[model samples]
Target: MSQNGAGVDLETSLGYLLKEASSALRAAMEEVLRPLGMSVTHYSCLELLAQRPGLSNSELARGAFVTRQSMNVLLQALERDGYVTRPAKAPVGKALPTRLTPSGRRSLGAATAAVRSVEVRMLAGMTETEQAGAFRILRSMIRSLNDGDGNA
Candidate 1:
């Protein structure tokens, strides 16, 4: 409820709607990824490595929206499973740069297709113009929210 006498209306709350949409998208992605034995974060890490090889664990964690510890754990499992590889020692700094193995690339290919299908389905009803407009709107909203100072 809001501070007013009346409570906040869920039906008309854009934040609530956006969160619901995000949850639905995640569920759909998980459904498709489950058969491939990958979670959304797992797939995200692989995809990030494929696009930008040699990303550090911290970078991968930020890209995948996971914690550093969580990313380190996943990287360990991926190395064990032959999906990714990292140097025995960091070449320069404390950051162990990670990269995708051949096996990881193959796995990412399948996951990419599955994730793309989910996105296509989500945008099925929207025309190209509407899709572009929605993209711009969403980006603007994100920028607006992120522009705030930490004092808030």
Candidate 2:
């Protein structure tokens, strides 16, 4: 309990701290991404496409942590803007596999550099070993939460 017996001792609560850290990380990413006319979700989508090559709308939505409808809207804009491409019709089921165009890959390269700077700044104070340990701990926490919710 806190000194005053509050509902939760946020100063020592890992979950509270984790949420705070996530917020800070997001703000920092947004600050960097704003000048490029990209949101975190936008960059995440491009980055996912860069790595995965041909991911479906729903798969990209899940990976980017956005709703399928939202992803579809973004995909439409991306396709119109010449950043991504989809077949005239679905190659297999109802899902159209999405891929990045050359322009999209070029855009992703710039975003990747900007995002990497934020990550480097965030990890500046941590030693390699400490960073590795933190990675393991954070992954464990994610697994625990996801598993508990049957989403893992």
Candidate 3:
């Protein structure tokens, strides 16, 4: 704690710690994905599609935490490269559902392995119980933050 108490104590702040952890994790993931010609968002999109096929662009954008316009640009490139496919016309509304091509699946397989390695490395010092506790704690933090009103 600071004597003046004028601002946050970054060393003991949970928000600062969480942001630091997130940044480290992102850097590690990027290092592993670089050789595979994939970015974090690209891998996220493919992983999401593999788990949930027929996801619309907007849905994918949300899942990947990118803007819809950025996702659309990526989708266009993926479609052009035959990594994914969307129907010529929407079966329902203007939302075009996307699916992974065989190539995309193969690519995702490698990316998944890489990501798993990073996660394993990050959790190397933790026991099963500790990991479970961490999961619960992190989920609680997320829920609490999301459930809060504007006024803290």
RMSD of each: 2.5, 1.9, 2.1
- Decoy 1 TM-score against native: 0.91
lDDT of 3 by residue, 1-152 (tens): 45665678887789999999999999999999999999999999999999999999999999998999999999999999999999999999898989999999998999999999999999999999999999999999988987876866
Top candidate on TM-score is: 2
Show where candidate 1 strays beyond 4 Å: 1-5, 149-152
* Residue-level lDDT for 49 in candidate 1: 98
What is candidate 2's TM-score against the reference? 0.93
Runs in model 3 lying further than 4 Å from the true structure = 1-4, 149-152
Per-candidate Cα lDDT values, in order, are: 0.93, 0.94, 0.95
User: If both were scored by TM-score, which would come out higher, candidate 1 or candidate 3?
Assistant: 3
Q: Lowest summed lDDT over 10 consecutive residues: which window, candidate 1?
A: 1-10
TM-score of 3: 0.92
Cα lDDT over the full model 3: 0.95
TM-score of each: 0.91, 0.93, 0.92
